[model samples]
Target: MSGLFSSKRLRWFAAAIVILNGVFPALWILFTSLKTENELTQKPITYWPHEPTIGNFISAFQDQPLLTFLTNSLIVAGLSTLLSLFISALAAYAIARLRLRFRGLILTAIIGVSMFPLVTLMVPLFEIMRSLGLLNSYWALVLPYTVLNLPICTLMMVSFFQDIPRDIENAAMLDGCTRISALWRIVLPLAAPGVATAAILAFVNSWDEFLLALSMNSAVAYRTLPVGIQLYQGEFAFPWPIISAALVVAIVPIVVLIVIFQEKVVSGLTSGGLKG
Candidate 1:
């Protein structure tokens, strides 16, 4: 009883520390966005603003098309995530259930594609995009993000699928359900956590991706939030207040996602823990 109590206390303390560490940086940026420029540039930076203002927030949109960036981000990330999740679910289902030769090798190969350095592929990806007229379009970012994120999403769904007993699938088949139907009806329903996990991760990666987004879209109209943040910089100095305000705006979608899908992520990660 004493040992269990101590273990629970330690876990709670560790969780608190982790939560604080994650939230602290965001809080600092939020605070800085409210501070006057002079206070931010002070010898000893102020922890709390003496007079908080919404000017930075106002300037973020006024100075540039921040809303356009946000919209582009949403379109690219949303489409890429949806496509990646759908394809990953199909691929993961096959890998988990199909009696294909070299199954392990195929999985490893997919993961290997992910491990290929992003930089090395950039030049080829750029040329391909230009050849296909994908440059300066959302498809440029969306396609690359979906491809890059597939392996991780596949692995995630695979783990969740593996946790489900084979008997459930067989039972569904015995009930006259086709293999595809069994997957769609039985397996997928049981793997909601994995689906949510893959979707969230794919969305976040596409939303935050910088290199592809930067190189793919030369037009301001197609620029994403991460690259759009750079538009505030100049030869003279960085606009710290405006950048901080942009970051605060940028944080909202991510925060909302985590809040909505936090449980699914946690469950997907721990999906197979009880199984073997």
Candidate 2:
């Protein structure tokens, strides 16, 4: 009885600590976002704003083409996620089910590509984008983001597919289903969780991608949210409140996505980690 009580107490304490850790940073950002520039810069730093206002958010958007930046970000991230998921799902199905020559070798190579530092490819990628007339266009960001995310997404889906029984595929085949039909009808439904996980990851990566977006997009209209937010800072100084507000705005969609699809995300991650 005592041991059980102690364990419960420890669990409660751990939960409280985890909640605190997660909530504090968001609270800090929120608190800072509400502060005026004067309050933010005041000596000895105010923990809470004396008079909270949405002026920072207004100013942040007013100072730049934030709506256009957000629209571009949404298009790039959304398209990148969809493309990555589509390509990776098909490739993962092939690698997981088919017995091609050097299948293992190919899978290893795909995984190995993900391990290479992205920075190493930046210059080459930039040159390629430039030569192809893709620079400053949506393709410049979307294509590279999709390709960069594909390896890991495919690997993740492959592992998830492997967890499913081969008998299921065989059954579908016996029912006169083609390989593609079986994949679309049978494997995809079972692998929905994994696909959702891959989509979330791809979306987040494409949305947050800074280096490539920065290098490839020069037009203010084409810039994504991250790059747009950089404009909040003048050459001489930064706008803390406006920057904080912009950051808060940027995080909202990601938070909503995670909240809405959190169950699938958790299930996919956990199931992918376990071998059947």
Candidate 3:
């Protein structure tokens, strides 16, 4: 009994440490955003703001076209997530349900492709976008984001698809449902947790992507939030408070997404673990 109690306490301590590690930075940013610039520069640092104000949040927008950046990010992330899920679903279903030649090799190739560092792809992607006349445009970001998200999304869904019984799909086929139709009406619904998980992951990746967005969409009007946020820092000086406020703003959508889809994400992860 004492040993079990000690083990439980240790697990709780580790979980608390992990949670604090992730939560502390965001909490610090929020606190900093609420502080005045004068307080930020004071001799003695303060953990909590002595004089909190909404000025930084207001200034974050006024200092840059933050709204436009927010809009661009939303459009890019949304489109990319939809495309990633659509394509990944088709590919995953084919890999999981269809007995195609070299399916295992194909999956391995996908995993290999996804493992390549984003920096290495930058030059080639930029040149491709330029040649296609896609640079400084939403498609420039969306297309690459979709491609970057595909491998993981497909692999995740494949695990979920494999977990589902073939009898369910075979019965649907007896009911005059084609494979594609069954995938739409049956397999997909059954794998809703995986779908939700993949969608959230894809959206978050696209939302947070910096290198491709910065390189491909250099135009101010086309810039995403991560790239646009840099405009807050001048060569001469950094506006820490206003930048924190913008960072806080940038964080809200992702936080909301995770909170909303958190259950599905956990379910998908747990199912994947068991499937493995």
Q: Candidate 3 at residue 137, lDDT?
A: 94
Who wins the lDDT comparison? 3
Q: Rank the candidates by lDDT, best first.
A: 3, 2, 1
Work out the TM-score per prediction: 0.91, 0.91, 0.97
The residue-by-residue lDDT of candidate 3 on 51-96, one tens digit each, is 8999999999998999999999999999999999999999999999
User: Candidate 1's residue-wise lDDT over 12-123, tens digit each?
Assistant: 9999999999989999999988987888999776888889999999999999999999999999999999999889989999999889899989988998998998898999
Considering TM-score, which of the candidate structures 2 and 3 is the better prediction for this target?
Answer: 3
Among residues 3 or more apart in sequence or in different chains, the pairs in candidate 2 whose N, CA or C atoms overlap within 3 Å are: none
Best by TM-score: 3
The true-versus-predicted C-alpha distance at residue 113 of model 2, in Å, is 0.9
Candidate 3: residue pairs that collide: none
Candidate-wise lDDT, in order: 0.91, 0.92, 0.95
Off by over 4 Å in 3: none
**How much does candidate 1 score in TM-score?**
0.91
Candidate 2 lDDT over 14-118, as tens digits, reads 999999999998889989999988888889977988999999999878988888988999999999999999899899998888888999899889979999898
* Lowest lDDT 10-residue stretch of candidate 1: 267-276
